[model samples]
Target: MGDHDINEDHAQASDAPPRAGDGPRTAQAKGAVSRWTRRVHKIYIICFHRGFAAFLVLPLVLALVFVAQKNHFGADQCKARESGCGFVGNEDAYGLGIRLGVYLQWLSVFLVVYLLPSEERSLMTSLITFSSALMMAILVLTFGGTCTYTVEIIVLLWTAFMTQALASITHTAQEIDDAGIREVPVISGLKRATTFQLNLDSPQGMHGFQSGSTLVEMCILGYAAWFWVCLLRGAEMVFAATPCGTSLFFFARIQDRKGIVVISALMTAVSLATLLFRLAAWIFRTSVKRWFSKRTYDMLGAVLVSIVYLPITLIAGITYLVPDTWMLKMFPGSGGREQLMVFLCAFVAFIVSVAGIELLLVWNGISDVYGVGSTGQLIPLTMGLVSLMPILWKLLRRYMAGEPLVPEPASNGSGLLIRGTALPHQGSPVEMAARQSDREALQLP
Candidate 1:
């Protein structure tokens, strides 16, 4: 049962006389509860604040490296097949670099949020987390008009989804923290579940949650709309990339008056226009027409697109990676062709990424640097992997250990947000039990 239910029961009980047996039982429970809560609190308090700081620092440093390497060369496969000397026909690589910059800034915001004490991460943290998502979603929408590579589209959508998922998890954590949930609910034993699900849509779930604010409503609506748009756009991209996918897409288009193309153009135009408007609002306060301060609109947009839609995009992206078996069942040989194209496109992208980084290193006057003669070709790849090492290490360690390598900011913060709506202001029962036991046993009030 939820905390509110428990509170109601207590209120009802208070109106009636207590049973003769209750006083002794209540007294007996107090000592044990006090002892447990005290000990558990100490155990959870053993957090490595420094570790969280380090996590934030590494991403920021690498993000800078990624931005500096913005100069791009053409995709190697395109250079080999189309032009003898060089090719600059497609600006995909350039776009990818810019997107990475966007990714870096978003990542920094996420990390900075964790730097503050969990309790302090209120609506502002929610904004920061969701805004990062919105920025990326808009970028994807803006680019959806032109991008058609099968593998690249898959990667872009996949990355978008994963980033948003992480952001949502973080946002849920902040909400829980704000709601004063110090302990995650217990399902099994004395051990606590590190991560539990939280239902962001539930106002009653959070103790002090109030959703009367226009910003919150906008966030909910905006996120839902963006998610719907991205899913449609991703489908369109898939259709455009594959021959089999395209034939069906066009047939559908024939039925729907070329809807995919229209969506692509409309989405790109609106996303671009929204960005420009945000800039104009900031510079000249043009959002005065909306009757709210320009700042409020900014906040509203952040919550809607970044927090809500970002995660939805991620969920949709995962569906795209589903096996082509359904298509194969319809046509025996078509799947193989699509698979080959994907592999080739992936290879092209890998070559392009490495070349872009290497060119940047050379351009910055790093002559014949660390890996030039023997491992020259591998230099860019090496740095890229190195930049990702910190994140990779944690993920790999978690995989091997079957648990998180580092503790979350809250005792129960590391894992999934449990789909909970109402929790007591004190925390879950396990938290209450532990806290009570600790305090009583240790002679603390």
Candidate 2:
């Protein structure tokens, strides 16, 4: 009777219910959710595959067919003309148009990569940046048009937008986590938490190819797309004079008469200044990228550089494109002419100033990254050297080509001075002076 009672009690207790913190039941629920998520992931992958194939392959095939049909040549036509006929050919712009389309295509790809659920985004960003860089290089080398540059600018802007969106999402998710919150609290908080944790573990939260991505996350990811767009447009204004005939169709802004006059002048100046500064940065290897965390400095520097680039480009562009007669009319003949010269001088001065800013930015980057003092010490030399190299190199090369070398003001490190002698070629006076200056710079305490 006692044994029977004991057995019945044990069965009843087991049948009553499972207690809280039952590991097996929780594990089973997790397993089921994992299966469902996996299925969803598979479907997403398939969708992406289809989209890529349709968008990329189909368009490529159609483009090839269209080009062939439009540009076909007749075999008998050449024989008819003893002298080769200057047959009507396709516009170079058409080719540029195709290239522009390709760039936009890549931009679209980046958008998808950036917008996809987080787990797959890292791989996508790596593929996107690398691929786009190659395409950009190709466009730069071959097409070399304002249209090409415009596309490049657009792509960069798109990248900024994508980055900001990712950052915003990441920040929001983090905030949610800190609040011990679920995105959909009503739909099983534990499951949502588990899924979120899974996303964090995946590439969705971390990118592999990006440098100082943590800093990037802190810097760029939390920002909005509009801010990035403004910066990109500002940067684009630096080289605003170049004809982007078709690109205007895509990205141009209409202006009132007074506004047009003002904007044109501003853009031209900014563009010229930015271009000169970029040249200086390249020559000196005084990249802001070297001094600071690539992500942080790039984001911050981007803002300042863009602001400077915009107004300058507008001025230069206006000066170049506007009728000289009209420009001369705007200010009285003597005063306007003087103002024109002043504008040119100011643009040049701006370039020199920004070159200094760029060098300082570089030094800051180096200090931040490597704890190196070399950058700080070399800052002034880098600034002066970079600004001078382009003007000197261009002039020297021109002189070598037997072109008349018009003298421009070269800095004596004390003040701007007229050259007493021509700039050197193969150990010329200027070369010797530069070497001596460099030596003195290197010896600085």
Candidate 3:
């Protein structure tokens, strides 16, 4: 009986499931699987984040390439005819198509902004609207009466708007961090560096302003200023050379050396005046800390800058309205010196304009105060129609079947509505707590 009982015990022990870590091969397999899972997870996270940038960048890149090719062809034609080109003379269906793509891109941006949380949405909308308006004004002044270059102008406007929006977003993120939200150490450092580089505000404490790092930051910003000025000037030359218009006149009369030189000189003077005013304002704010509130200073700064730029705006309008003959008489020369002066003045104006606008936006909080306008509303309304088609079809089918217009909430097997419950709520209390802790640690909303 004892032997039989012992044999039954041994059989039962052999039939039971194997314990964890019982074999070398099993442990090795688990380790390998865990490593692969972590690698895949890392890869997925990178791709998911980078996908957003790719979506925005790829379309713009293609559009630029297409427009550039068209411009090249137009330039060749202009050379063959040995005449200037104007907007009315250079009508191309391809340019119109490029403009359509730009519109679609703006719609995409608007839709994405709509999907964001309320605070983020408001911030993004404000920045986008302000940037859009500012860019539009700049483009109109730069390429007034040159409707043939509309494709280039549209592309540039979108690019500038995105640049401002993204920069503002970064600045806002840093503010959020300072308000208690935390980020990864490396990421936080990078954000701080970027904010410092872009913002005109002096950092707090003597150490911050006096540190060697401050000099490095200034140098970097200077390099950025140089780069942008070169880019804008290059684009200006390219657009001027490209064919357009009815009797083949240069867009913006850019080929008219004297006119271009005068315009550039005026722009440069206005830009410098604005910069000087900004500097004075900055000094006042720093020296007389209690003179006026920060908001008051910002408001006054914006008003003063606008006033400083008003003369240039008026001159540009007059130039646009006046006949070509009168303008030629007013500024009559086609010398190499005039061309050189135009290039030099343009470079300086571009640099100052970039700096002044950035400082104005950051200091005045214009982007924060502005809200989305008619243009913003039109974008989503136009784009959302396509997205609504599937839902509309579903509703129609439901109506035909005599069902309720609004569907009921879906429930899981556990009899709980799934609509509002987060995934963590489905787990045990301990698991939920652990997940909550993890989220808090990561500073997730």
Candidate 4:
């Protein structure tokens, strides 16, 4: 009888079905949620691996190779495969030298920005960083060579300014005349588009960014380059005036007074020409003029370009003739020269910094402005200050509600159950009661 009872109990336990309160629906819901989540995750992974490569990665690699070539020579020589010498060293390497100079100045700017980490950088920022690095690497190649300190300074500042300008344009512009809107050039096409994807007739057509911002970025870059050239000329002139003892041998051996005078004259003419060119460009949107006139605008831009060329031509001319007095005349005076120079440099730096800051602000406001706009420096500073308001409000609300400064999960045992459904405890109530009774009986014995 005892064996039969035990057999009957085992059979009953085996035949019994699960209770309806086991939260089977909740389990099924969780399974559905998990499946969707996995699908989304897989899509993201595929996009990252394939799309990033097809659109962004391959172009970057090509740009890097070009950068490597420029490090050895300049941008000009990178494409010159015919120059008998396969690479090591070549003649009149100064043009490449100037390119190297631009790279270093930008490096300092990059370092300063990192001091305050902003939110995550976007594709535009990454491309700018890459381009800047490449430019800097090229500059380093010319570190101890024949390029003068003045030339290096000018190049560095100009290069950095250019990189920043390009970044702003690439991020904001909807399309270039060539590149389709969908696949824009992130950095290389600052002034104009150079990427393969910039086809004009694609479905993602270009709508063009704000003309104002583009003009500003271009102007800033132009001015930065001009400033470097001026500083270089002025510094060179000053050094010429105070030749050290070591310069005596070379000074005496070479004396071409007429050549120096002619060179100086040519440089002056060029400076005037560049100034004219700048004026014309500012007035007339076109790169080429329809007609020539004696208008002051055309004259000014021509003068500035001419001026940029002047220092080189001027220095070359004076290498033999004018002597130290002429140089001193060209350099800015030395009455507290250190203080004056600092103030001037700072002023220019402030303007460039503002250019960068304004770009981000305007981009955020892009939707309303048709991806084209300019905000005052004051506006950016104000916006940056105002961004803090939301963060502060969140904090204040938390404090007022008497909510724990940090979140604390509920402490009730029953409340520990998840939100959607209730799950019953395992085992039948009758079985639990019988087990308790058996325990009581044992204690009594």
C-alpha TM-score for every candidate: 0.25, 0.21, 0.26, 0.21
lDDT of each: 0.33, 0.32, 0.33, 0.31
Position 280, candidate 3: lDDT: 45
lDDT of 2 by residue, 1-445 (tens): 1234323422432322344666896765565444433333332222221221222233333432344223323334323321221121112221223223323333333222212112223333433333344333332422232222232333333333232333322222222222221112212323422443323333322211121222232222112122223233444331221221212111233323344444434444543343333333332222344677746743654454446446544564465565658765553332343246334544454344334322322322211221223333233234323433444564466467554343222322111122123323455676445434322321212
- Residues 309-338, candidate 3, lDDT per residue (tens digit)? 565345434434545565444333322222
lDDT of 3 at 439: 27
For residues 359-440, write the lDDT of model 4, one tens digit per residue.
Answer: 3222222112122122322332233233334334533553564432222211111111001111122236753353233222
The alpha-carbon lDDT assigned to residue 58 of candidate 4 equals 32
Candidate 4 residues lying further than 4 Å off, grouped into runs, are: 1-152, 161-174, 177-217, 220-278, 281-445
Off by over 4 Å in 2: 1-119, 122-445
Tens-digit lDDT track of model 1 for 164-279: 33333343433433342232221221121122223444433431221112122223223333433544554532212222222112112211325644654554454333333333
Worst 10 residues of 2 by lDDT: 241-250
Scored by TM-score, the top model is: 3
Of models 1 and 2, which has the larger TM-score? 1
Q: What stretches of model 1 exceed 4 Å from their correct place?
A: 1-96, 99-147, 171-239, 242-445
